[model samples]
Target: MGLKAVLSKWFAAWANRELEQIRHNAVQLQQATFRQLIQQAANTAFGHDHAFTQIKIYEDFKQRVPVRDYEDLRPYIDRVTHGEANVLWPGKPAYLAKTSGTTSGVKYIPISKESMPEHIKAARNALLSYIHETGKADFVDGQMIFLQGSPILNEKAGIATGRLSGIVAHHVPAYLQKNRLPSYDVNCIEDWEQKVDAIVEETYQADMRLISGIPPWCQMYFDRLSVKAGGKKIQDIFPNFKLFVYGGVNYEPYRTRIEESIGFAIDTIETYPASEGFIAFQDTQQDKSLLLLVNSGIFYEFIPAEEYFNEHPTRLSLAEVELNKNYALILNTNAGLWGYSIGDTIKFTSVNPYKIVVTGRIKHYISAFGEHVIGEEVEQSLMGVARQQGVDVVEFTVAPQVNPPHGGLPYHEWFIEFGKAPSDIDAFSQQVDQALQQKNIYYTDLITGNILRPLVVRSMKPDSFINMMRAKGKLGGQNKVPRLSNDRKLADALADYVI
Candidate 1:
């Protein structure tokens, strides 16, 4: 093994030991984090407004701070953006992570100096943990690529502003700098398709091993690479490619097609990262659940998903969270976000060391008939049937079809793009609908009670979703088609491409 690989193994061992300590003392660490965040931000404007100085415990904090989304916190964020000192966190934020919001247009989430290191560290520790468990560090010596937004930053109110991925691109650790690709110039291309082409040209012949990105975009890159290699599988183009790291969306939906593109199965790591904080990462190959970052500079709260829309929902801290129940995740972080709801929902797989799986988004669900079907349920249902039928799904989305043109009964509409269409598509659709009904009892009641009919599947043509996203100018960089929507906004747009 090379010197770099040897050092990686040693570092992984040391990091794993520290991680074990953190795992053992997860609750205490979170308690300490809560105290420190409150103490340090006590002088900030929000702190004063929320009575932070008088707060002594989690109960006090909870009573003083109500759960807030971006709109709720925008007034304070506006002040910070206008160069006000000590508005959110102490002094000014180091960077503002600009992201697209559904209702709020654009959001500038602060990445404080104190909280930024944890983001970088958590990602590193994920890889180190993998190395420690698998003892596979040779990939560290080969080319690594993280398909992401441009590293270029534009100044917003004198603070660097860009996508969270772009800001992180600027902080690539020195040791891995030499092994990272495609060239910085190529990464700066404004268009994603052009950037992928550039990336393919630059790294197709290199010893590329570790490939990282959101799954859909990774699929795009693989498609381009295959075409460029005259239809060679990704593993043939870069035999050294082993580890597949992904986040931002569930991988199960894309796993079959992605593995097929690579021409074989490979080890994969799933991470749960957002502009707010690095929440969790897969620590073990045995369990797909992500180990929640309890010791990280963030305090977590959970409101049961079903109660999220209630007038006053019950909020519970990490210690109070239970297993197998979906919760709308809330955050209080060193970045000065207090009781911030980032819109994602998660379910704990294990509470001992606090491992969780991203269930879906709080806002991204279908309930047209009062039968709420979440992202996890839809994904699990569709993928389960797809596995049974030996079908490969390229992409899919679900939305309620409240009005039928022929005045037929209302039903859920599923737009699916398949790599290999099932011979009997009607039978396939029936299986998927039945799977969803089994997963959600409310949906079953609606179907049997004549309130709704079985779901209709619209098999889409090749590149249908890709064309839709491109037409909407959201082709890449953390933008994803919502798995399910309560309304027909996405379904209407997708109607143009249905086969």
Candidate 2:
């Protein structure tokens, strides 16, 4: 092993010890985190308004603060954006993470100085944990790339403001700066296609090993690389490439295509990161579930997913969460977001170590005919059937076709872009429909009662979804198509690209 690899192994060993302590003390750590966050932000305007001084327990917090999404929190966020101090957290925020929201348009999430390190730490620890477990640290010596947004930041009320990934780019630890690829100039390119082209040119011949990004964009980079290298597989171009780090969307749907592009399977690390805080990361190769960061600067609450839309849903603290039940995740972070819902649903796979798997998005589901099918179900159904049929799917999305133009009963419409088409598309579609029905009983009831037909599969031309995203100006850099939608907005838009 090289000197850097040896040093990395030592660091990983130390980091894993700390992580082991956190895992063992998960409940106590969360309780302490909750108390600390409350104490730290007690003097902020939000805290004062919520009567933080009087709050003594989790119940007290539950009674004082109502669960809120970005819209409900906008008034306070607006004040902060305009240079108000102590609106959310104590003093001014260190940075504002600008992200796109469906209903709220653009949202500016605070990243306080106290909470910023948690993001960096969580990301770093995820890698270190991998090295500790797998004893693979040689990747540290080769070129690493994180296909992400521009690093350029614009000042908003004297605070740095930019996409979360862009903001994170500015904080890459100095030690890795020499090994990071796609130079800053290429990273700053605004247009995604131009940026990918530039990245391809810069790293095509380099010793890439650890490549990280959302799966779709990473696939794009790999595709561009293959073409530039005259159809050579990614592994052929960069023999040292070992690990794939991905988040934002489930990697299963893209896994087959990604591995095919690389000409071999690679180890991967999954993470659960959001603008609010770094929530969790995969801690072991044996179990794919991510370990919730209990010691991080965030206190978590969960509302049963079924009860999320109720007038008053039951909220459970970390200790109260049960394994296998879906919960709408809520956050009370040191960054000053209180009783905030980021709209993602997760299910715990293991309670001992507090490991979880992201189930779906609360808002992103197909329920036109009373069958609430979520992102996880759709991904599971399609990917399961695809594997059975030996098919390769590049991308896909599901939406309810409430009113079919041909006048059939309402049904779910699947828009799929295939890398390798199934030999019998009809049979493949039927199998996927059956798989979904098995996963969602309500969908089965609807289909059996004739209220809705089996899902209709619409094969999309190659690059169709990519073109749609490009048209909407959401191409690349953490952007991903929603897996399921209740409305036909996306379904109708995808019509133009159907083969």
Candidate 3:
């Protein structure tokens, strides 16, 4: 066998062993270890902070750390952006994963090799769980597809120069490299402009069995592939393409178009990917994803959604976290971020201590549709509609907009990009509306009041939204398009979002 093939085999075996060990440790030592992790952070980092130290000295310890928001970290981030080391911990971070900030300029997030284990473990577990849950791995070598930001590394050297996705790509074990489509090594080096051409050039001939990435961009690439193959259809291009793996953002808007263009239904897997680390992945037949690497290398904290929005919210330790509760995620990782809120909301689906569902962004609310649809609700509704339609989609997203009034009432708008074409758009929309009504009572009430109507699907050129997000300085080599924007500013700023 070739060296790459041999490495792939060896690495897969090693990764599986590691996952089993992690799972055992998570179940066995989770509680005490989690507590120890908190104390360690306090002693190593938090204790050094004057404010935190003062609280400790005063015997005024709160059950949780005072809640932190992005704004709260601005001073530290400013220091980092301007080349501040030792702002949060000792030593300079190995790299900064540049991502966008709300109402602010760019954020250069710190990343380190110490944090690599959690990120790598999370990724590996995603596939393992996918296989265990879907029973697909028993078949032929399942080809996997990853739809993500271009893996291109920054030209400059140092942590500040590398994107999170790029850094992860760089560290992917060489053994797994053999199994990855588009080869992470190759994809991680090419510039964005060269990527589509590269994908079109290679993937057009690939018998791709698995696909992964953000939904919009995936749709865009497949659309180009379809056209290049003279409308041969996605199935024809990659008949082996059986599963779609997606994360980084919601898949509602682009699902319909992706399935339509591909001319067939395909199984989809969703994950919660963060620059700080990969946190969760869909593992069971149920809608919720299993927390894959809880005890891998990071200690987690949760701030209630309500408290998280407050000026000074408090966070809960993992020991205090419970099920079916919405909370803003705070993370302390080996990467050196302490009490850091990653700006996402999540909920535990069960009390078993190892599964979660990403609920929404702290501030992403959709009132245009009167649905008040957040990320989690939108995902549930989209999946419901897709299952009802017997549609297996690769990727999707939902954007609420003011529909041109038919009778003086604004309607909820949907900017849909899909791979498979459903037989009926209006019928499909009604189905979506029904699903949302069932998923969220507020949305149903809004629909009944005519404050919002069923979703209106707006067709755009393939990759329009993905390009738009990139243009707006919102997306980069590794980040994703924001799921919900109240004004549809992203929809209008196509040139800027795409570049």
Candidate 4:
């Protein structure tokens, strides 16, 4: 290692100590009474700014603020439009993290100096939690590989305007920065497509051990790593990569493929991440639920899905949520995000407080033709089908298409990809149709007889689906094949585009 690398290592050591202190304090506070915790958080926020000091002001304005989303905070973003301090925050923004969702067109999320430490702490805690769960604290002292974006710092010196990822890159620690990776400065990013390509290239050559990021990106990294190692197994490249930490989006779709690609059935932990902050991380070994970061200097609330989508929506605190129930997440973070609904749906896996699993994006549900379909339902159904068929599935996506029903307008359709397409496509389709009917009774009622023939299943090789994603310029990074579609437009479009 060079002098800079040595310094980076030293900095990491010191950072680890600081992280331990924070974790210790956080756990102590987390164990405190709920009311006490809330008061502490309120006090902390108050100390952080005068705006928060006036409890009466916040109380009076809290309910009146109207639960907000990214779009609702557009004006706040406009205040810090050029990294300059305005109504949003007190100081100039270091950089912006660009994030995309159904409604928000590439949102430029600001990361301030005060909030920067929290983001860094969240990233560190994700690793720490993985280590604690896997008993791999000592393992972290070894060569670690992070399959994340390039650590390249952008030359431009202002908050990025549109991209959440870019803005996040700007706030990363400058001392621990790597010269070989891509810049984190979103302001300097002009050609995003080229940047993604560059990221893939460097990831292909880097010596990595500790892997991170979304499962889709990890699949792409494994592909590149496989090629670079001359098809050598993952255990050979990074035998020390005993732990895999992933978040951002769902991992169920690519679970088996990743285990196969990495050539090891290692300890894997999932995280709930966003441009705003790290929401939760898997605290247990089982891949069922996540432990919400209750002590992470943020206040959380949940809005019942029924009420959130209806005329009157009421917010519930962590104390009000129930086990095995789904709700929309509303957050109030030190990052200046208040009453922000991130459009994610989550369920408490256990009755114990602070543990939940992100089920799906609220808008990602499919209710076309009156068939209410959820992501978990579709995933479970796919798992059930795979079990019944006795075949291992690497990856799959469900796209709803429509063709004319006899002579009038068409009914809904299904498109699926399987590891081994059954010998009889027609029979397999029938089984899938039955599975859908069994999963959702509404679909059963719609198709009285052989009304809508068996849903279509398109079998492809292991990487074929990922390749299709790549062809769409989404390969080798954080993007994944969209799981559920509302209409046939995407399915119809995929027919010609995907092989």
Candidate 5:
């Protein structure tokens, strides 16, 4: 066998064995792993004072380390950035990934040398797992394109800082870097649109086999690539394309459009890697659920989503997390993030092997009129309606119009950016309304009882959401339009560009 093929086979075999072990004893590994994580960082300033050494199980750990958000731990992170030894972790972090969500301008997430291996291993093993399960080893031999954020690194508070993806790109294994496309120069462009233009020029006709990135940005790349290929499908540009590896956003809403762009079916892998840590990935194609990363250097916790925003929440360990409840994710990592509320919500699909689906963000919810609509409902409803309508959704957000223009009762206002605008706009709105009502009974009752009007749909002029993101300094790289908002915060900003 050729050298590349031989190496791929070896790696696949190793990963398969590891996956088996993880599946067999996921809960045990999870508990033991947290204990190890505490022990590993026990001497660090945060851990030593918290009595990490005395904590033997999940309950004790929870009692000691209360769940905290990024702002709550910002002081310690500041200490780490300023070169304080053992402030949060031992010594200093190797890098601090800068992540900005809908509201937070930028939060520096520590990447410790001790925890870096988990980050590296999770990424590699995810791909290897895909190869083992799907027998798709040809990608390793051919080019892979990462529609990454700027590779521009800045020295901030005595640490290297950039988007997590860029930091990861900078650390791509030397061997594989040789086969990755869109040169470093193209990857360095700060502007999202400009960078996409450069990327299109760099990789349109390359023999690329794998593509990875956030869905919205990758869609931008694919859209431009299709145009550059003279309106040909993605398969025509890179015939050997085998995988669409993605994270940072749900791919369901974009799947139909992406498949249409690619012109054929291909294998896909989903990961739930956040700035805090690598959480989960689609381990086997059979389940279509993300297997939790028990072996990664992070201890996990889940707070029931309903109680998460309350003053006190009941925190549960992997063993206690029940299936089908939306729980806000929490973590204590070897990287020195202790009991940090990651702000994302997830639901356990399977507890045996510990698989989960990200349901929404803790802050991304709408309960303006007691109708609690979350990210999952909005995404699933949109996907279902768009798929049935034979249309492509670009970007969307829903806000309760508390102040109705005609002195009527309050109602939802949907601002959508459509790649292919649907004909019969009223029918499209009805479909969207029906889909949401089917998913959320409260929403249905609000309309059925005449408490709220049918949702108002306003198709946005193309690029409005992009402009909004740009205005907010969150143009790309993991930042997303909040799927649902309690107030007209984003809706007011986006309505100016309605068609």
Candidate 6:
């Protein structure tokens, strides 16, 4: 056996052992790990500032730190940028994971020494989880194409800063780096188009067994690879392509397209990773829910999503979370982000084993007129209507049409990028509207009371979202267009939201 295979086997056993222990007592593990982190960092500035030493339990932590978002932590982050050490973590973070958030334009999340091992462990465990279940470890012997950002990062006071993918690129485990394709030179090409071209050139004939990325960009690469190989499916080019590791967005809408591009069905593992941390990952093929990272260097809390917009909401610990309720995730990390709201909403599919499904983004919703429609609801409705109409949605976003130019009635507007346009656009719009009304009662009340007109469906060119992504320089890797915009900011810019 080759060195890579032997290495994979050894790592798999170690990771799976750690995973099994966490699963043994997920809640107890989270509780203990959280306390240990607080105690370890009690001497640090942030910890001392928050009285972490005085905090005995989750309740004490809640009382001391309170929930915060990126904006609230900006001052601390700014201090870090100006070379302040131990502001958030024990020392200045060696790297920052930069992201353009849908709401917060730019964010610099600290990647601290304390959390580096956790990040590495989560990634290894994710891959090992799949191997443990499937008993397929041969792919590690071949290439694992990581579709990532430019690896060359700019330094801020001796601290590296770039997209999370780039930050991770600089630290990929030396052994696994051999299995990763696209030379550092190719990866350092900042231009997305040029970088993608270079990656294809380097890996087109390599022994590619796994392709991992955000689905859209990976699909883009496959499309390019097909054209380069005279319209052959990705499977034709990489015959042993065994797994597609994907994250950064829901895979349901893109699954059909990706499978078609690949020419054969391949196993896929979904991960819930963010600039803040690697949150959870799919562990079992039989069940679709992701197993929460209870023992990672992160402490978790949740506020009921439906109640968060109220004057006050309850913040619950891991043990307090109820099954199948949408909750906005709050995280306290070893990286020194105390009680930070990650902004994503999730639902627990299995409370005992701590399995979750990402429900929506807290800031990404349509609540213009008190009819709060979330991302999960919108996606389900769109997926259902498309399936019914025998169409595929390339990309989509929904917004509230609260004001009409001519003082006309208000409505919900959908800007849809479709692979196959419905035979009758009007009929499709009705289906979307009705499906939403059936799912959301407040929406039904709006229609029943004549507060709004029928929802609008504007067919967008398939590449419309791509154009927007290109303009944002966030075409892939943990960056995603919000599925539901509470305001007209993004919808208005698209022009398709215009009634």
Clashes of each: 0, 0, 46, 17, 0, 0
lDDT of 2 by residue, 1-499 (tens): 7888999999999999989988899999988998898888899999999999898899999999999999999999999999999988999999999999888998999999988899999999999999999999999988899988999999999999998899989899999999997899999999999999999999999999999999999999999999999999999999999999999999999999999999998999999889899999999999999999999899999999999999999999988999999999999999999999999999999989899999999999988877889899999999999998889999999998888899989888899999999998888889999999999999999999999989889999989999999999999987889998889899889999999
Per-candidate RMSD vs. true structure?
A: 0.7, 0.7, 5.2, 5.8, 1.8, 2.0
Cα misplacement distance, residue 50 of candidate 5 (Å): 2.3
Off by over 4 Å in 3: 1-46, 50-64, 81-84, 128-160, 178-193, 206-210, 233-244, 251-269, 283-288, 311-314, 367-371, 382-411, 417-434, 444-479, 491-499
- Candidate 4 global Cα RMSD: 5.8
Model 6 worst lDDT window (10 residues): 490-499
TM-score each candidate.
0.99, 0.99, 0.76, 0.77, 0.95, 0.95
Evaluation by TM-score, superior candidate among 2 and 3: 2
lDDT of model 5 at position 422: 83
Q: After superposition, how far is residue 354 of candidate 6 from its true place, in Å?
A: 0.1
CA shift of 356, model 3, Å: 1.4
For residues 1-499, write the lDDT of model 1, one tens digit per residue: 7899999999999999889977788899899999999999999999999999999999999889999999999999999999898988999999999999989998999999988999999999999999999999999999999999989999988999999999999889999999999889998998999999999999989999999999999999999999999999999999999999999999999999999999998999999889999999999999999999987899999999999999899999889988999999999999989999999999998878888999999999999888999999999999999999899999999999898988989999999999999999999989999999999999999999999999999999999999999999999899999999998889889999999
Which ranges of candidate 4 are over 4 A from the true structure? 1-62, 82-86, 150-157, 160-207, 387-395, 402-412, 433-441, 444-454, 459-473, 497-499
lDDT leader: 1
Query: For residues 104-182, could you state the per-residue lDDT of candidate 4 as single tens digits?
Result: 7667666556666666666665665554444455344444444454434443246534344434455555543543144
Model with the higher TM-score, candidate 2 or 6: 2
Give me the runs in candidate 6 sitting further than 4 Å from their true place: 1-3, 496-499
Ten residues in a row with the worst lDDT in model 1? 17-26
Residue 65 lDDT in candidate 3:
46
The C-alpha lDDT values of all candidates are 0.94, 0.93, 0.63, 0.60, 0.84, 0.84
* lDDT, model 3, position 112: 60
